[model samples]
Target: MKRNKRKSDEMFNLDDIKVYMQMSAKDKLYWLERVAKFLHKITPSKNKKIWERLKERGF
Candidate 1:
């Protein structure tokens, strides 16, 4: 038997967000860069504006 799951728009959990908010500045920057790099990789080159901007700024 299969179970059904209800989908909602709550993509982020408040508790998780609170923990992330408590992370130190260096940890926050590390996570931010990781997410940005992941986004750049997954997003198509044509839509990779952030990567292009970063390149222009000498990343």
Candidate 2:
């Protein structure tokens, strides 16, 4: 039998958040900021810094 899930404005767990961060750093940072916004946490404004760092690593 299949179970039904409830729909609520709940936040993802830390593990899920980590998974998001494991995405390409640029994408990771973008999602990180979005999740933070949902949880009212502080996150950097731009992903430029992350992109620059990745570029420095020759990504």
Candidate 3:
């Protein structure tokens, strides 16, 4: 029998949670803020519809 290996993208480890749990309160908040900013940058804005309409009219 052969064993299967997980690809890097498909691999997940619980050690990350353990490390997070051991972080200081200040460190945790700092990481939280960083994550929030990252998410905000990746997300689209609420004015998407207006942009779409303008593009459709050759703007």
Candidate 4:
């Protein structure tokens, strides 16, 4: 079944794309790949340092 899109899900809207535009090419590509594989609509930015911290926290 499909789930409802929440405010949290809405957080991944176009503004997130704006934040992504500020990143370097490699960083943006890395995140683009990650988000492409993400199952949930709530995907994080394509920033490696942030991903590293998330991994460190066991995300």
Compare the candidates by lDDT and give the number of the best one.
1
Structural similarity to truth (TM-score) of each candidate: 0.62, 0.32, 0.57, 0.36
User: What TM-score does model 1 achieve against the real structure?
Assistant: 0.62
Candidates, ranked, lDDT: 1, 3, 4, 2
Off by over 4 Å in 3: 1-12, 47-59
The digit string of per-residue lDDT tens for model 3 on 27-58 reads 99998999989877876886666777999999
**Which residue runs of candidate 2 sit more than 4 Å off their true CA positions?**
1-22, 41-59
Alpha-carbon local distance difference test for all models: 0.76, 0.63, 0.75, 0.68
Clashes of each: 0, 0, 0, 1
Best by TM-score: 1
Candidate 4 Cα outliers beyond 4 Å, as residue runs = 1-14, 39-59
Worst 10 residues of 4 by lDDT: 1-10
Model 4 alpha-carbon miss at residue 41, Å: 13
RMSD of each: 7.5, 11.4, 10.8, 13.1
Tens digits of per-residue lDDT for model 1, 10-56 = 66666667778889999989989998899877899776776689899
What's the CA error at residue 46 for candidate 1, in Å?
A: 1.7
Question: In candidate 1, which residue pairs clash?
Answer: none
As a TM-score, model 2 comes out at: 0.32
lDDT by residue (1-59, candidate 2, tens digit) is 12334447645455555565568878867866887677554435466577679999999
Candidate 2's displacement at residue 28, Å, is 0.4
Candidate number with the higher TM-score (3 or 4): 3
